[model samples]
Target: MILYDEIKTLSDKYEERLKSQIEKRVSEMDGDDLSHHILYQVLGVTSEEGHDIDVYQNKGRFLYKYAGSFLEEAAKLCIKSKFPDSATTRVDNTLGVRPKKFEIDMLVPDGNAIEIKWRDATTDGDHITKEHTRLRVIHAAGYKPVRVMFYYPNRTQAQKIQKVLQDLYNALDGYYYYGDSAWDFIREYTSVDLYKILEKIAEVKTGGK
Candidate 1:
């Protein structure tokens, strides 16, 4: 329960940071960033519409960043509550030359190496190559590679990449969990129902309860 309170405080802090940053950006946009409207006008988008678009996009960037970070930190807290000695670790990429090392999000002493992601929405095909090498490195390091992704990709190409990654994980005898499954995996393994607590917090914050 104390950990849940910590997550709630973290959510508030992130929300405040988001609001302050957005306000600063919007104010700066009033005089300095308006030149982008010329290009938008050439593309037939009005200045008013362009300004709205920029604001929306800017807000989206911050929201996504904060959301991802909050979930990861919260998940870490939940996991640490169960695995007191678990920690984030770096393992050398023995199978590759370019990537020096791979960062494992959570490494329990029992050899479960977790890679946490809020989402993987990249359409880049090379993401697979990088991930393959990383998993291979983790596997070679005598650790079981596990992926716990809170959200799945929405676009078709991104989904396809995720599918391939899932297959790769399976091939390497690793574990993969996405969306609801990722949350459940944490709950089952850590004995902490983070998803439920998060839902309750959201309801209370948004006055939707």
Candidate 2:
């Protein structure tokens, strides 16, 4: 229960900060020049000479990609913020032999897999396709206690996704993580307050100088 409360509080804080940051950025952008699809392209847009794409610069490099990297960075930052020396726990820096192409978003010291997703619950087809394949691979390879974490901006969206997963997947017996249920599963395995870490990471990235 404590973990769930902490998770809810952190989710609330991060979402509030993210919403404000997005509003601020939108206000600064030239709305008249923005197109409908352009507004929707949070992941990334291809680099073409005459594509009329919006280019942003940071640290002398073109900051073209968003969404996935942004979410991943935030997740990594949260882990670092909590573990400090979590660099070694991450599988990204290490490589090993595998039968097929696979990547773990975050790996705990106990060998648990964490997959993070933030998208439209109604349209995102990952649960049936990529996620199923990834879990099957991990299980076949003898990986224990894998987790799929879905990050929504609010409780309503999170619940909707939870229902969708429940309705669609018979294979997902106890692998999906969202909101309080996720917090419970995470706390059962580790004492780390993942939700609080997420909240802190969001605050630092969106509001920090």
Candidate 3:
């Protein structure tokens, strides 16, 4: 329950951050308050024939796509700040591929695989299954101290996944986090505020945009 409370606070803070970003963008649109307009545009973009159109108008989709990677970077940074060792937090590292292949989000110094997902619909059961396989294979290879942790935001679509993943993680001796619970996991590992890290990343990214 404490984890749920932490997650709620973190989710509220994250929503505020998003609202702030939208307000800033609207202000930049010649003070037109086009946040709603932008939202409409974001929801309007669509993929055709399994290919998405790459255009400036699709900035919303682009942001949504990059959010997961950005969160991974934030988590990696938090871990490195606490560890201060390059080898402690490796991002997007390919471990091994013999009987099965494994590419992970973050490889902790303790040999834990941390897979971060951000409410993307594409990251469904199949994705979880693959990651589970990778973890099992890695564990079988005498990888001591091996663990897999999944972090994802809580959304309407994620309710079922949260249940499914809880069972999967339990069976694997791993952990699954959703909503504010994920913030608890990050805090447990690094004692850093993920929301703050994400805010800084957003600032830097907006400058480039």
Best by lDDT: 1
Report RMSD for candidate 3: 10.8
Q: Candidate 3 — which residues are off by over 4 angstroms?
A: 1-57, 84-100, 123-125, 142-158, 197-209
Task: Show the colliding residue pairs in model 3.
Answer: 7-180
lDDT of each: 0.90, 0.48, 0.53
Position 161, candidate 1: lDDT: 96
lDDT of 3 by residue, 73-178 (tens): 5566666666654333322224544333455556565656566665544437676666556656545543422222334535655556556656766676666676
Query: Candidate 1 — which pairs collide?
Result: none
Candidate with the greatest TM-score versus the true structure: 1
Where's the lowest-lDDT run of ten residues in candidate 1? 28-37
- Per-residue lDDT for 123 in model 3? 36
Task: lDDT winner between 1 and 2, please give it.
Answer: 1
| Of 1 and 2, the candidate ranking higher by TM-score | 1
